[model samples]
Target chain A: MSEKVLMKGNEALAEAAIAAGCKHFFGYPITPQNELTAHMSKRLPKIGGTYLQAESEVAAINMVLGASAAGVRAMTSSSSPGISLKSEGLSYLAGSDLPAVIVNVQRAGPGLGGIQPSQADYWQATRAAGHGDFKLLVFAPSTVQEMVDLTGDAFALGDKYRMPAIMLSDGILGQMMEPVVMPKDSIARIPERPWAACGHGDKREHNVINSLYIEPPVLEAVIKARFEKYRLIEEKEQRCEEYLTDDADIVIVAYGASARISRSAVNAARKEGIKAGLIRPITLWPFPTKAIISRIGNAKTFLCVEMSMGQMVDDVRLIVNGKRDVRFFGRTGGMVPTPAEVLGELKKIKGGI
Target chain B: MLTIVCGHYGSGKTNFAINYALDKAKEGKRVMLADMDIVNPYFTSSEYSGILISNGVKIISPTFATTNVDVPSLPASFHSIFETNDEVVIDAGGDDVGATALGRFSKKVKEKGYEMLYVTNMYRPFTSNADDSVEMLRSIERTCGLKATAVVNNSHLKGLTNASTIIDSLEYAKDVARSAGLPLLFSVVPRSLIDQLPKDEYFYQADVYVGTIWEKGED
Candidate 1:
């Protein structure tokens, strides 16, 4: 029943948000992602939803916090610089356990590096971005369709766990135009948030939504409880996509745009009679580590391709535990390695690794 | 010296600033390209940083700030660089609202004595005529708190643009520049269509062009 339409990754994300019953959106314009804000700006009003272009990314995320606290499905988005501004809010959301969706259509960065597609923020998105020890449910989408599908899943996961969820995409995924199927009307309505700051109205005692737990023991207990929830998430929510891995000799592990590039490289390697396959992590934080580790007995080598200079390679190395030979190919600061480049690297690794 | 480029959307503002920064860096001048555009997704100067950085040009963009509820602090070195460096190029965003961020540093920039050029492409939206161009300029001036020192006419109709279209747009922008008391900086004559135009008045123009757009098959 899904209707197919050609859309950019940003537009698909906005549509998915709407379909997921997110009624509030706050964001500022930033490259590789303005289409998301623009789409929300146009459609949210018609659907009786609120859309505000906050003065800055900081204000936008805080606005999302306020909306999320009000028991409404709310979201915000940005590129690298803007996401940097929202990191504090994300930590606060994670600390407070407020369920919200944050879409980061990542662009190149160390500083305001570039607007081109980049997966450099993998560490920032997967690990604790802000000061405290907290994790965002990170979903990495390889295609525009996945961007739409995962945005809905991101909101669902956030609401289910009462935590922040991030659609960790790069500029290429955000801006590239592709065909996407709009979810059918049979999509489930999100349940009302019990922890939200909807008016108490003498129904019960006042509820406070805050990350600040002053007492050390009480804070420690809260963090321990949060970690338990993360453990549960790790057990149940580790999602990944595997292709042609049954008899493959070498496995290429990647995510987001890099996954798409790695897929092409795998296909090229297969044509040359090398048994190569791809294992793409859809959820970064609940990183399909167990699945990857399970494949290690059969796979001889693993190649980690990323847009950053070896950020995700560490994770692959950790999962493989040095049992399998691991190699890396990457391009930093907004440069996307062509499929040919990735294929050439695979050729170099075919016999050696 | 800082060379700031400002313009409407799709005016090739980023394109000019990026190539100019690269050119200066090639000339052995330490150049830095700062992208201040927070609007418009398709075009911005920050996209060229990888190439510029590899070529030894210092590229500063807004992407460095972390997402937090608080206003993220910028690097301390940025301010020091302007005081010490001989060459700097700031590529402001397309819309007037995007250009407003430059106002925060306008006083410091003026103290440092930098030149700001307003890039005008008559074929673009909101600046197709003299009145429209003037209104756009006034909005930019109000936002930045400084008047544009010069105007660079960079007219094009996307893929359909020709030399005549460029000439006509330049004429329209020239009138606006005269009335605003700003110097007509130069025209961007694409090398592909450069030979078709008369070389009399625009002979001294800097042929502002970037290599063909990076398509998938080129590499």
Candidate 2:
């Protein structure tokens, strides 16, 4: 067994990225996620990797795009508002079909929101980040161990699919410390990108990496092709964790830090014989619709718990399709909902059921 | 007893200070925990103000702590800690940048004759080795304007810390203490891992407080 060491969520993600063969990290300083950048700055130079603090989030993301186009695994991380500044670059990455990792250790948002943990960026991440039609492979990690595990997966999967992947974490998880067992062999197998802009030196035809397709029909064809890849991802990469949902009456749909709180609430409800279960969406972009659809048979009510003002509840409601009562219970503006409050919400739903 | 804890970031200084304060409070000594950590906005000792206050432990946190603000503002002056006849535990911030706040109280603390304990967790980023740990201590001492009197080996991997983990870090901790020319005070062992070790006065058994929201029951 590998030795388990305690690590904060942000630092663990940085280590996992390095282990996944990510040699280039360009990021701007932001709360909660700054530790990841700090860790990268400390560790990357010793291993002959590149760690750069770009002037702003925009520059950091473009740097990631440049490195990824050069066929190197690159990453950039920021908080909610910082992510907003990088959204245009995100669209460009998707349009160019480049592989990279983008991490958002989400803070409370709208405009210059509080620095506390919040899941308010669900809409921005899943639906529309930039001004175009593209999807980012989004992963939500509830624990520090999961943060370590998914960071490696994010790099690999993003490279495999040729798209940017976002690790949608929150401030609570970013700042919290937990024990994580690292991968036994830190070295990872980096896949070869055939269409990279890295110089071939007359070995083969020069490959061009660009997102500017001015012709409308050509752009539509390109977008449609990308959609085909996204369809495959939606089919294959929808991941979630189901706890006690096999025979549950109330299914709580949550992701990231809210899921951690919901898990405790589910246990408390189970102790009180409320038959509450939890479906934690590990991949937020794919949205884990299969997990919710399968549980709709036995689950009488679906409670969508979030740190936002019911952003993810829309997804849950759409997935449930009015078959079951979809309710939302959230505490936004940096206020975290306690397990007791969530358990109380479960009991009220149970009583109604 | 004026015990000021300082260390690198994530070195478990806050955990050690809390347990030390609680231990002294339980011993019927008047304890005052000054949460002087101004760097980190999260996971500070000020978050446990209710529990600390209820346990008869007077707590003084930085201004705007536990609020929505991230500004590192200390009190204009500290009077209660100097005035009271209580066993004081000042949890200083991490690294030299965080420890700069401690310089404000240098003269008063020096006159009071205090033991500045430099906490070291070997698993942390910068202080994983003796040289780095010693450099960190010297830098902290320079910024804080006080000399550390002893070394605290609070080395553990949070919840994954086993008896072997602590035992293996013995020489590393001793090396840190020796390199710093400070006496090795004691190694902190969590309450669960106490039985695995042979009883010795060098072990300080402590309950792991100051944890995540999910790990509430463990503390």
Candidate 3:
């Protein structure tokens, strides 16, 4: 195993991508995530990788699409508003059936809200990433180590599924530093991409990658086929971490930074003799419904904690399906909820519900 | 002493500067910390101005220091760094780009006889070796137009740091100082691990004050 070294979440993700055989990075500078881009720009050139600061987020995502279409591991990163500019490109990538990695190190949103950490982009990531019928494999990492781990997974899974994957990180996770043992830089077994549009060479048939479908049935069939992949991913890739939830009365559902706070809250609740537990979702898109459903029998109440205005609570309620009372507590617009606040909310649910 | 802290990004310079200022203040000396990092918007010393001021350390930060604004303008009171007799610590930004902001005040800083401390964490990406670390220090000096007086071996992986981590970095840090032709002033160790290591005048035991939101109170 490699020695543990301290690294910021952004730089860790960049290094993880490189270790996973990502050699192309096109991005525009944005706060909270500038370090990731800066790291790539400084390191990639020395390793003979391509790192370009595109004119804008739109240009960057399109450049990623172009590089990924050529069967290279390419990625782009941005903050909230910049991710918004990449939405059109995201939809195009989905429709074109291309594999790429997109990083959204979220800050407060709506319209250039603030630079502070925020989970407000949860809905943008999970439900409606762009104007299209598609779903991105969204991984929310709470720590710098997890950021490094999940980034490799994001690239591999995106390639395996032949669709774009989103690493939904927030400002807190992006800027904070922690001890991380980077994955060893071994030879990445890059899978053969026969369907890529890298020059035909006259030996085989030409490959065309496009999102535009002029015929209705053809587009319908393509989208339905994409949904089948989503279903398979939903069944197979649902991942989460359950903390002390085996025999608890209250189950707190959270992800990313909120999950870190919720874990502490659960611990505090247990110290007070309150039977509380936490279910932290590692994949936000898969939703980890199995973890929540399994606890529904023993858990009496479900408390959802988030850094947004209860965007993820909707999914929690949808999964609970009226089997139990699903309550939500969130602090929006760049405010983070303390463990005490979450514990208070847990106590409220324990006492009343 | 007027101390200026400069280093590559993610080298723990901000934490070192904060610890140095607070320690000076604890000795009942008037200390001031100037947050002159215009390149980075996150994790600057100005964010902890409240605690620093409460501990009796004066602060002067760039304009829109803690806000969402991304301007590079310094505060109007930045000239006070030269005006005051208080022992001042200027937390310069990372790399040559970050240190470029400090270049504007280079003449005054040199005239006042500043002890520029080049902080280094070999575990970081760019400065992972003595050669690379020395090159970075030289670049920072070129950009800031000032010479470093000493080298500070602040080598550790934040909370995961152990005695081995420090011991392992000793030679690398020494090489950095030796190659740069500067004296190894001191090495920073977490206060919790003080007993496990040998006592020395060159060891500055520091409490980890800068941390993420969840990891804050735990430290």
Best by lDDT: 3
Q: B16-133 in candidate 3: lDDT tens per residue?
A: 9999999999999999999988887678899889889999999999988878776778988999889899999999998999999999999999888889999999778668889999
Please count the clashing residue pairs in each candidate, in the order shown: 19, 0, 0
* Residue-by-residue lDDT tens digits, candidate 2, A30-70: 88787899889989999999999999999999999999999
Model 3 lDDT per residue over A241-342, tens place: 999999899999999989998888888889899999899999998889999999999999999999888889999899999999999999988888998899
DockQ of each: 0.04, 0.48, 0.53
Evaluated against the true structure, the overall lDDT of model 1 is 0.79
Model 3 misplaced regions, further than 4 Å: none
Residue A116 in candidate 3, Cα distance off native in Å: 0.9
True contacts kept of each: 0.03, 0.40, 0.46
Ranking by TM-score: 3, 2, 1
Kindly list the per-residue Cα lDDT of model 1 for residues B60-114, writing each as its tens digit.
7664432211232335555754676658888887657668878888889888887
DockQ of 1: 0.04
- The residue-by-residue lDDT of candidate 1 on A205-305, one tens digit each, is 66789999889999999999999999999999999999999888889898988888778778778889888889999999899998798899999988899
**lDDT values for all models:** 0.79, 0.89, 0.90
iRMS value of model 3? 2.6
Error of 3 at B167 (Å): 1.9
- Which is the better candidate, 2 or 3, if ranked by DockQ? 3
Most accurate candidate by TM-score: 3
Query: Candidate 1: where are CA atoms >4 Å away?
Result: B1-219
